[model samples]
Target: DQQVKQNSPSLSVQEGRISILNCDYTNSMFDYFLWYKKYPAEGPTFLISISSIKDKNEDGRFTVFLNKSAKHLSLHIVPSQPGDSAVYFCAAQFGGNFGNEKLTFGTGTRLTIIP
Candidate 1:
């Protein structure tokens, strides 16, 4: 029932400050991970991703870190902005699932940036 978990339900951050989000997984078959941002009515959009082989990946103000031994991953946002406020979801994909392409996701963390 708890294959993947997002410890934080919500995060409040001040504009121009740093926002941290975390996730943990119990499955080792997952070889790829992704972060998605979703608005109220629209569909979730792909934000960024990292391979299990990499420890850290960064793009602009967003950075994702993966720790295999701890089965933990984190997303760091520096200088948080109002536009960045949204429900962020973390998803995982199993490797060698050649015929079937599906992603398992952890509960999303709603991020609020105070302006």
Candidate 2:
């Protein structure tokens, strides 16, 4: 079964602190991984991504680390801000068909950054 899992339903952090979100996948065929951030009433925006061949990827204040051996991945946000409060989804694309590589999303984790 293809299942991307986000264990924590929510996370709370004070502004300017670091925020870490974890995800797991059981499917070995997933070669592309992505993290998306969403605000209320808006679609998710791509944050960071990593291929199965790579172990880490970073963008500005966001970093994503993939541990293939452990079937796990994580997103780290540095100096978290109050504006960063939103839902985060971990998604993966599997199979050779890029067009058919449907995004399997986690249940989503709500991040709250306290001012």
Candidate 3:
């Protein structure tokens, strides 16, 4: 069964604006969450991550917010740039240490930054 979902298959954002990508999960057992960005013909690269204990995490232009009560999470990119365009994936892990956790990934969302 598909436990994670990204409802929006694609999103477009103007450069220099904020881009919000959303995801939802059906599995409440998941305790750790992560975001990855993939470029064409390249592997998905880790972006940001948040633990189940925290509501939000930020790094540079990227931020991830988790709403445990609703089983929802989002990635926010501020001042989006053309280089930020990519396919974004949201992942969850349950019951393991960070280094060894098995991650479940959502269907990716394609984000395009319009210049």
Each candidate's number of clashing pairs is: 0, 0, 0
Residue pairs with colliding backbones in model 3 are none
**lDDT ranking of the models:** 3, 2, 1
- The whole-model lDDT of each prediction reads 0.92, 0.94, 0.95
Please give the distance, in angstroms, between residue 8's alpha carbon in candidate 2 and its true position after superposition. Answer: 0.2
lDDT of 1: 0.92
True-vs-predicted CA distance for residue 70, candidate 2, Å: 0.7
Ranking by TM-score: 1, 3, 2
lDDT per residue for candidate 3 within 33-80, as digits (tens), equals: 999999999999999999999999999999999999999999999989
Of candidates 2 and 1, the better by TM-score: 1
lDDT of 3: 0.95
- Identify the runs in model 2 with alpha carbons over 4 angstroms from their true place: none
| lDDT-best of 1 and 3 | 3
For lDDT, candidate 2 versus 3, the one ahead is: 3
Residue-level lDDT of model 2, residues 54-113, one tens digit each, is 999999999999999999999999989998999999999985775857899998999999
The CA lDDT at 29 in model 3 is 85
